[model samples]
Target: MPLTFRKSFQILPGVRLNINKRSWSITTGGKNGPRHTHSSTGRRTTSMDLPGPFGWRKTRKGGGH
Candidate 1:
């Protein structure tokens, strides 16, 4: 089955924060998803979800944090 656990947050006028099972990314553009400034994946631990800016955190495994 397909994973539909994606969540998005607007950080600015045309910038967004995207969180999914695979990665957490910052997308910048209009209407559609981000087309720039995508970061590489990293291993995430339990402490990564302590609330703050998720953009500064590492990517987690499984179905998001």
Candidate 2:
């Protein structure tokens, strides 16, 4: 959906909004479809477990909280 905005001032705690509606259609790919993929040798090289929320910092600095 597309929307447009207009300028206006508020006095006593008021809110303003703009709304727009749109029509959607599917193309040749169809609505929600998965893409193609290549197969792997099943080496299991990656780790499935990691420190929860702060995983990003651990990659750069070398430790987890």
TM-score of 1: 0.46
Q: Point to the candidate with the largest lDDT.
A: 1
Off by over 4 Å in 1: 31-34, 42-65
Worst 10 residues of 1 by lDDT: 42-51
Write model 1 residue lDDT over 10-58, tens digit each, in one string. Answer: 9998777888877787766663332443533633332222345543333
lDDT of 1 at 57: 33
Model 2 regions more than 4 Å off? 1-20, 29-65
> For candidate 2, which ten residues in a row score worst on lDDT?
37-46
In angstroms, how far off is 36's CA in candidate 2?
A: 20
Query: lDDT of candidate 1?
Result: 0.56
